[model samples]
Target: MDGPPATPPAPKAPTLGNALHRFANPGRFMRLSGALLPWLAAAGLALSVTGLAWGLVFAPRDWQQGDTVRIMFIHVPAAWMAMGGYVGLAVASFIGLVWRHPLADIAAREIAPVGAVFTAICLITGSLWGKPMWGTWWVWDARLTSVLVLFFLYVGHIALSNAFDDPERAARPAAILALIGAVNLPIIKFSVDWWNTLHQPASVTRLGAPGIHVDILQPLLVTGLGFLFVFAALALLRTRTGILERRARALMAARAAEPAATPSAVAV
Candidate 1:
């Protein structure tokens, strides 16, 4: 009797999750990022220098703010980076939680400290910019409070990620914390409209066209893009270093365990 031919199984459908899975291999990620890093670093440096120089030397001074307006090049871009970096962290955390992707886990770990630095830069620069304009260095304003909370969230994530000797045990909880803290992002962005705060309303990112003049706007945009590129380059660099560190740790642990598994010889 002739047997019926078996049907071949259907191929898996393409998807974002499936696409991201390719980055799970550390070797592949390392090779690709190594090639990409130099370009990002150079672009970031050139753009940042051009923007700061244009803003500081060429941009017309605000009739109201006078020379203090120059600080916008640094302060505004920093605030943007702080919030943007946190969003990236939350996304990486989601990828880590949902897929248990090792690279995502490593990325989440590396991003926290860099995000924290951006948050701190925003706070410090905000204070300095405020001291001259607002007449005080500190305020309990809604936007400021929300941003401070964000800084704490970054600190908490860093603390949690390194709390245990075994990182796998800590990964899920830290990821969950990042997701929870993302609730504050909307609060930070909308704080001006949500409440009467000391901080000004949206200037660059308004639903309507931007309120600022082109002279100020151009430099601001360049600096903002520059900060984003630098942040990406830094995060990728840290992730590559992390992958190498993990490899070293694994080799050392394996060697440490090797001797205990061997039997000792007895002399006759």
Candidate 2:
């Protein structure tokens, strides 16, 4: 018989990192995400509608740009989401490269298209706004050019991600490209201050108070947040769909590979 009772070790404390890793299990992720999907969708839609309506209908027009400033609501949000989305891509790529996580790789692949769309929207609206303000539809300014490069990076990642039949092989190169392309993000952010450009300098983000008027900035912030929420919801939905499709393919292939059931020797 033991003379002294031994003390039991304390259970490990829960951590944010550890909790997040639980989603690495595809079955666990599917169930949780399915339960949460409707809430995300509803919240994104509601915020987007409210923000867009407020920005378009209720916000005051700028004296300098007049009604043309309305484009900022749309253009600014898209621009922010484009960069924010790229940052997310780079993060996902980093995770994929280091951990070889299937979810991270799938997330990186799915994020590319959404980021590209936002980049395209940014360029289009910027051009539309520029035509009236700058008297041109296009300009090779530092900010604009950097954003263009960002767009190209997104496209290249998408192409590379799909180039290989083996997703694992494809993931490495795509992840590398995403990491490399992350260099362009800072350039896009600082291009206005770094060099002369038709594009305006920071209005909503600055050293002290935002340069933008509050009447305009409030709706802009709301719309930007809405855009961010929608982008997140969309990316998660795509990732979920990708996971389901992959599982379906694996099931089909496994069934095909099964030995044909021996036709019952038909005893006449």
Candidate 3:
């Protein structure tokens, strides 16, 4: 008889990459996010508070717009994040479509609503500022119209993503839409120059210098950073909530499938 076949060596213990694989599963993700939630919340709160106080109180008023310019603290940051978030979602959607990472679809799904909300806030706040500054509540200008299209794109993304019962099926078409809409981003940025619109020329970046003075720049930076932190915190929290919800549903289904074994198992 031949000698007993030798067993293969056990695989090396899993690393962080493996942990990430496991984390992609909803249950493990929920645990990790639960642990991280408090820290994220604290950071968001601190950043928002500091930014608001410094921006509203300490930052010098603009020479051109004066007190009316204060709205920039909210409007500019929201506008930036609105565009930034779509780019992020589109990237995540691409990953989901190509690599099929489990968390990628979840990310894409959650980010749409957040992006839409920010876009809406930007539009509203911008309108409020524009009415006084531009002498109109709304204009059919290129910048404004492109931003409107962006808002509608966000709405379409969120609605389409949830329209299907099968998560995998929903992900595929939604991912395609996100990728396509990403093309609109550069269009939005250049629309002001492409057409003579009411929106002002780029003040933050032009030629070799920023037009805004240091005093205004300082609070703008603070508010921008604060908005970034808040975005991160919200995204994390929303993704975690989605993971937990899916896990809980799966657990409930699993429990339902498990038989009771007639009360005798309980008696024993």
Candidate 4:
């Protein structure tokens, strides 16, 4: 019987709130992810399958692009997510720095590689598409240049974040870097107008409406949603893995610190 009676065990740790505050308990994080992963996995599979079916089989070939139009479903979404992921990283990094949310840092760290992959895919595929359409493998246009900057930014974040010995110290500078790079995204979006570039003007977003027709648009939209879900699922899985790895390292360090106990029970 202590003086304060142990402070009521901290009110049972509030699962619903803990769900929102995921980094509060590693066990809760594991449980929530375990429950959610299956659904995300299922939905991702279903969407990709359905979207591929529509895009490849049912959707009409573009009169101009022909079979190459199929590539747009993948290319456009990869480009969108590449930019989207970087913005997410910057936001998460900012939250981690300002609020000191551990989960936010993990999210930022885990997402960068995925974003980099998407950015590379977007660039390569765009180049491939451009070769046939524009008669060149690469161009010095504004859109392409901005995307190249994005790629280098991702590389810089990855390299700089790991350069420091202390994780916290590394995280802060990396966060700042992410914020600085985020400004390039808007430049990437508006580059066609601000500067004369070989890259085409906005086709997807226009004052009147989308330039593309419904038949192609439906597949494009479907694939985009599929890609979005896939990104979410992958991000969650990677973040969870990072959390577990950190916990394991902590436990190992704790074990190393404590003295080894002698075996007392009889054994065969």
Candidate 5:
């Protein structure tokens, strides 16, 4: 009698948790990031320069806003990165809290200051654009207010993360704050629709069609992508630095703990 064919081994399911776990090793992250860093940095710089030149010099002026509209090249991208950075921060924090990923805490810590700078750029540029268009340097508009709050949240996270005497103890509370602060992201996105404000409603991101003309929209998209690459490069660099710093600190602690050698033993 022919025996029944043996069953094949079941394939494992791929999930977010599993993927995160696979990349949790700090050494693996360092090697991968190191290999990719130069390429990412070069791409980022090239794109940024190309996009800025195209937008500032070549793109047609807006019918209504004129050259001041050119500010969007930097302002829009900074705003996008500011929000995107926080999302990354929150995700890193979540991974750190749940899986105890070795690099997650380092990622969260490094992302905060960079995100804060982007947020500040967004606000400053928004104000610069506003003064001419809105006839005011500032307003308590919903979108503006929420973005300001987001900036403060970034600042708070940075301060809190560095406040503790022990690096190991610093991450948890900041992570919790990050998770809680995520509520504001959606608010910032929807504020124009949710409330009447001085800020314009979505032109590029709306459903049906992007209200922006292709001439302007193309450059905007390019610049925005460049900013994204810049963010990635910066984050990877900072995370690598953080990893090296931790290793150095561990080495110092190990050396400090060793017993002092006797003078007689040294002479012998």
Candidate 6:
């Protein structure tokens, strides 16, 4: 007989990949999102109202831009979300392409339209602010041009994602497009520094001290948080809708494929 039994190996630690894999189950995600939806909606609405009111009414006016600077409350958050949304989309696309996660594919598809809307909002608000400050409705600046390309990429992704009758066939091409489009993101972020541009350089995110004053920065941060919450809530809603729609379609297809009963069987 052996003197002692062999020791067992230690269990492996959980990782990000394993955590993400847990959400691959549509039922689990639906349950989780349903539970969180109300809280997300309430927080998003409350924070947005508070932030907008604080920034628009209570914050001190900018010395240079005056009241027009208040546009920052909306424009800055929209721009941030536009960029952030694409990042989320690209990550989802990568997951879907590599792991073939159905939820990831749904996430990638659902995020495109939301990201496009945010990009549009950013452009419109920037134009509105520019008319007053820059004395023009639009400019072909590097930052602006890159962002415009981003918007177009979003539109293309949405179209490509839905082009095929079979969604499984659709997912791969859209994921590839999303990955290719991700190149524009870094260009959009660094456009101001890499080349001359009409757009202002970084204010809050710079390496040295922030260029903006505390009074303005506080509301900006708050508003940004509110926008982020809103995006999260909307994304969750869309993803859940997608999952339900897919399930419904699958059920319908299953019913359609069943063989019809013979006349004798029906009569009996």
lDDT top scorer: 5
**Pairs in clash, predicted candidate 3:** none
**Which ten residues in a row are the worst by lDDT in model 6?**
15-24
Pick by lDDT: 1 or 4, better one: 1
lDDT of 6 at 116: 94
Q: Is candidate 4 or candidate 5 better by TM-score?
A: 5
Model 3 CA deviation exceeding 4 Å by range: 1-32, 256-268
The digit string of per-residue lDDT tens for model 3 on 1-268 reads: 9999999999989875466566576666667777887887777678767777777898888788988788888888888889999998998898788768758788888888889998999999999999989899999988889989999999999889889875657888899999999988998888878889898877776678788887887777777777777787788788876666667777988999998688888888
In candidate 4, position 20 carries an lDDT of 44
* lDDT (C-alpha) at residue 79 in model 6: 93
Return whichever of 2 and 4 wins on lDDT.
2
Error of 6 at 107 (Å): 0.3
How many angstroms is residue 68 displaced in model 3 relative to the true structure, after the best TM-score fit? 1.1
Tell me which residue pairs clash in candidate 4: none
| RMSD (Å) per prediction | 2.1, 3.0, 3.8, 5.1, 3.9, 2.8
Candidate 5: tens digits of C-alpha lDDT, residues 200-224: 9999999999999999999889888
**Which numbered prediction scores highest in TM-score against the true structure?**
1
Supply the TM-score for candidate 2. 0.90
Candidates sorted by TM-score, best first: 1, 5, 6, 2, 4, 3
Deviating ranges (above 4 Å) for candidate 5: 1-19
Candidate 4 structure, TM-score to reference: 0.85
Candidate 3 global CA lDDT score: 0.83
Clashing pairs in 2: none
Task: Kindly list the per-residue Cα lDDT of model 6 for residues 191-210, writing each as its tens digit.
Answer: 99999999998888999888
lDDT of 1 by residue, 191-231 (tens): 99999999999999987889999999999999999999989
The 10 consecutive residues of candidate 1 with the worst lDDT sum are: 259-268
